[model samples]
Target: MARVKRNPMRGGNKFKLGVFGANADGCLSITRHPDRWMADWDDVLAAAQMSDRAGLDFFLPLARWKGFGGETNARHISYETFTFAAALSGLTEQIALFATVHTLIVPPVYAAKALVTLDHASHGRAGLNMVCGWNQPEFDMFGLTKPDQVYDQGREWFEILRRTLAGDAAFDFKGEFFDLKGVEGAPGPVQQPHPVTLSAAFSPPGRDFAAGSCDCIFTTFTTYDDAKVTIADFQSRVDKAGRQAGIFAPVHVVCRPTEQEARDYYQDYAVTRTDDAAVDQHMAMKKNMSGSHDPAAYDLYRKRFAGGAGSYPLIGTPEQIAEEMIGLNNLGFGGLAMSFVNPKYELPWFLDRLLPLLEKAGLRI
Candidate 1:
């Protein structure tokens, strides 16, 4: 393997790491497997504690209102993101907690206050993972209008949030989606200006929006070369604007002592027991709601729920998984977040087995 050079940015680490989907049931995998752990508070807390103790960087929960229909009823159970973040903040000593916000649902005024609420609980460790709504049915659950141009509305929503958190004196603003008059922003958040912000956007326009709007861009990639190209493009945009943004990749790990053991489990769980019906439901939703003409292009999206909605897989032994992380570090990825079938048991297992290799490889401190 090539020597992985740690990122040299003043505040950047070798690579940032976090846990995704621990706060939702089943980790988005539609299966009735015995190993699946419900992402209840106990489950999420266990994972959060392990990640914090292991010095991982962040925890992101997917926002879900309803579950896709299947025998498993995947992701039907969910914790509200801000409340989940607030609870995790008090329970753990470190590790940033990001509340995933469906920007359209919450007004910027209240959203700003809720963010501050978590920031106080975490003493500045709170952040936002803003997502434009993707599932039409999910939005229908809230009676929200499924806009013809969702990302544009998302841009407007973010602008309102951006200005609201800036906390300038009374201001008035009107936009296509939002209108505010004499809005006095909230007073203080522990983080300077505000807490960190992230957005999961993979398409070209979405990538540009993430690069220009957030401190970090969260995305899922299928290949290293593709990710390298996309990351370069996104960072170039951010750099041209005289700002720097981190690109956090999501990966799904199904590792064991040996590669075959891991592959067998993934093969059995992801393929043989794959929920094709549920996967199709999700894929159709993505194409219809996001206005993407080519949802099928996402290989993993078609492949059963690999890790919390098609995050890249690191399915191998601990050594192989560590090597994968090292390769991502070398490729200039800012961070990685992932999910597991059973985080309560598997998270500690991963930390115990993989943290040493990561440290040895110089990917973690």
Candidate 2:
């Protein structure tokens, strides 16, 4: 095996890390397999508190108008992301909160207002994860035809967000998908023109948008080499656009204790292959959606599971995971968006066993 090289810039500082809690139970659904697991607002609050105590830097909860993976009935439907962030802001101090917002489903003006509110509520510790809608079924439910021009839609949405959050009192936006006439956004974000804006785009246009506008890009690549190439590609786009390179953060499925223990946990949650119907539904949805079967995307997802790419890098002792994270820091990743097989159980392990190792590695939290 090739030895992983740690980044010199990191010195003793570990990169930032976060978690995903889109599912009610905070578990990644595998097609048809339905597990009666749902996380309540209390769970989210507790998790945030735990992460803060553990010295993690951020906590992100993705937004979905409808569930994509199997386990169809949307769970934890009451707490909208903005509202939840507001509540969490009062509950914890320090950990940054990133709420996902879908551009296709929300107007930019309204989205900006909500995010700005969060910035105030959280004392300027708010961020956004921008997503262009990919679910056709949800569009139909919203009484709209599926948008054929996704790139245009994304660009319009981002432009509006950027402008509105810039504290413009009377900005005009005229685009193919959206038209605004002298719109003003009040209570601009606390973070200067705006709070942190993040995105997870893999296509050429998506990459261009991130390079141009996003402060951070969420990626999902399986291997260090692949991640390096992708980062370099994104940096090139940013350079061409005359913008500084943004932070790169990737989501990982992590299990701990040891590599063998991590593998066992993955098998327990991800490899059982139950719920064929749910799996079929998810696959069908992917098959019908834009960029669903893109060869490169599929290859990355497969590598994540096959251990060539997707295997969790932070799955051993805290020291081990910290070392792996340090390696990624060397590769220029500013942070990680991580998910565990069972957060209720594993999160405690992370705080108790792993966090100190990160501190020892030089990360302040």
Most accurate candidate by TM-score:
1
Positional deviation of 311 in candidate 1, in angstroms?
A: 1.6
RMSD of each: 4.7, 6.3
Model 2's TM-score against the true structure: 0.84
Stretches of candidate 1 above 4 Å error?
1-12, 291-301, 304-308
State TM-scores per candidate. 0.92, 0.84
Q: What is the lDDT of residue 113 in candidate 2?
A: 89
Full-model lDDT for every candidate: 0.75, 0.64
Residue-level lDDT of model 2, residues 1-365, one tens digit each, is 11112211122334777666533443444422233236655666777888766756677776655653445442224346777777777787766777777788878888888898888877777878887757777777778765776767887898888788887478777889987988778777777767777786666777787888877666655567867887788889989989874555545455466778766655554556334344455455654674423455443454233221132345566666767777888888887777654455568877676667666767544
Off by over 4 Å in 2: 1-14, 29-37, 68-79, 287-314, 363-365
User: Over the stretch 1-365, how does candidate 1's per-residue lDDT look in tens digits?
Assistant: 11112112213457878888887777756556678768767767878888877877788888888877666667788889999999888788778888998877878778888988887777778889988757768778788876766678778877777677788777887988877898766766777677888887777777777877888888766677777887788888888767878888777778788889988887776667766666666666666666332354555355434344666788888889888888988888878887778777777777788888888877777
- Listed per model in order, the count of residue pairs whose N, CA or C atoms clash below 3 Å is 0, 13
Cα distance off (Å), candidate 1, residue 206? 1.1
